[model samples]
Target: MDWDKLRIFHSVAEKGSLTHAGDVLHLSQSAVSRQIRALEESLSVTLFHRHARGLILTEQGELLFDATQQMVKRLEATAARIRDSEDGVFGELRVTTTTGFGTLWLAPRLANLYKNYPSLKIDLMLEERVLDLPMREADVAIRMKEPSQADLIRRRLMNIRMRLYASPEYLAEHGTPSTMDEFGNHRLICQQAGAAQVAAGAELVNQLMTHAVASTLTVNNYFGVLQGVLNHLGIGVLPDYIIEDFPHLQRVMPDLESGEVPVFLAYPEELRHSKRVAAFRDFVTDEIFAFRRSRQTE
Candidate 1:
């Protein structure tokens, strides 16, 4: 399929009219229509149907629209990455990080990065959702789990440990569970990263040497989960770095320990050598580890 034709189809789909798409692309309506006609001929399927109101996509067109939208986005992003690679410190960065770190830690330091390099634009997308780098969902990503996808370069940003914590008041009221078996009696909070499959609990159990049951408050947001635990609502597992800031929450059964969670900085393997990417990657890796070790002292 012709890439240019796809671009024309994408514009028409967005604008709902060939004339409007032509205006957006700086082409004539005839040219836009020709591209669409050529595309339909090549695919041997009608992508759009003429309507009195404007253009309506056929069922196949809807599918084509979805795929084309992704294609255009990835192409634009890949181009931006290439353009940014030329200059050591300028251009846009679409970075993705989990909600907790993005809110408490990253959002603050991001200003400093912009201050130091004003030319570089930063789009900080924070969600429990892990963006797909291969699909150009993000230029850089910081995630707790290691990247299992092929053709991605990953770097360990920090080794993070998690512990069970609850507010003092809650512990007093509910009583702290001292052993793994006692966990069954307590209300637990769990964080589920957006519909993506995360590591199984059995892996965590093996790592932490504890058994975990189904949680009562199952939340997808990290900040909300942390707040619930801090408010003495329930016991939840959190990165040690997060709980370190709130002294009110005490570690429940410090001896019932979980192993360290590895935080990673990852991007597509093809783009790792880009100057802008390398700079941000190294900067974050240094800052996060330093932050982690500092919390160890407290």
Candidate 2:
């Protein structure tokens, strides 16, 4: 199948009108129509049915849409690869990571990456929402949990340990809680939404009520929770990455079990062979593994 014809078909399907597709592609309306017609003939299937206001995909067209999307993406990445075949790494590295990691951890190290590879442009998105790499929403993801998708590649970056900590002033003023039973005596701060597991159509408020411990302050984010603890508002469970060096805060209990949170780096399985992606993945894995090893020594 001609890729140009498939491009026209995909554009028409996306824009829902031949005129709009022509405008987008800088082609005449009749030219767009001819391309669509050629695509349909080559496939021996009716791709779209005419409607009064817009075009609607036929059953066969719906089936082809999935394949067409992947084909177009691979083709674009291939062209970019060809153009960037010189000495240095190039093209946009679309990375998504959580806000705390992006700010405190990755952003600092990214300067070295940019210094080493001046041609590569990085677009980093810091969000709690998970982005699908294979779908091309993001080319790389540093997520808290490992992805379950069979088509994606997952690499364990590190295991983050979380421990309960409180500022010295807060402990002095409110008194320290030495045991699990003493949890009720001290104020607690936690994420508002993740406090409880709620079923669909269940009462959201009720879940919060059941899960939320009484706090001097309620936080909307992980960093906010850390800030609350830093400001001496209350005790909070903080990742070792953020709290490891703080002098004012001390572990809440010597015996309280610390929990491990696994971090993963993910990308599309197909793009493993892409030079830019492979270079990035190997560099990140080495850097993080080195960090983990240094921490172990400390």
The clash count of every prediction, one per candidate, is 0, 0
Using lDDT as the measure, which candidate wins?
Answer: 1
The global C-alpha lDDT for each of the candidates, from Candidate 1 onward, is 0.77, 0.74
Span of 10 residues, lowest total lDDT, candidate 2? 196-205
lDDT of 1 by residue, 1-298 (tens): 8878888999999999999999999999999999999999999999999988899999999999999978877777678767865756887778998787777567767766676677887888987677888888888898878988888998887766656778888889988887767766787776653432234422443443345653567566657768888788888766667754576788887875556667788988767677778778867866776786777777
lDDT of 2 by residue, 2-82 (tens): 878888888998898999999999999999999998888888889999989999999999888878888877776666557
Give the clashing residue pairs of candidate 2, or none.
none
TM-score of each: 0.74, 0.76
Residue 97 of model 1 has an lDDT of 85
Question: What TM-score does candidate 2 reach?
Answer: 0.76
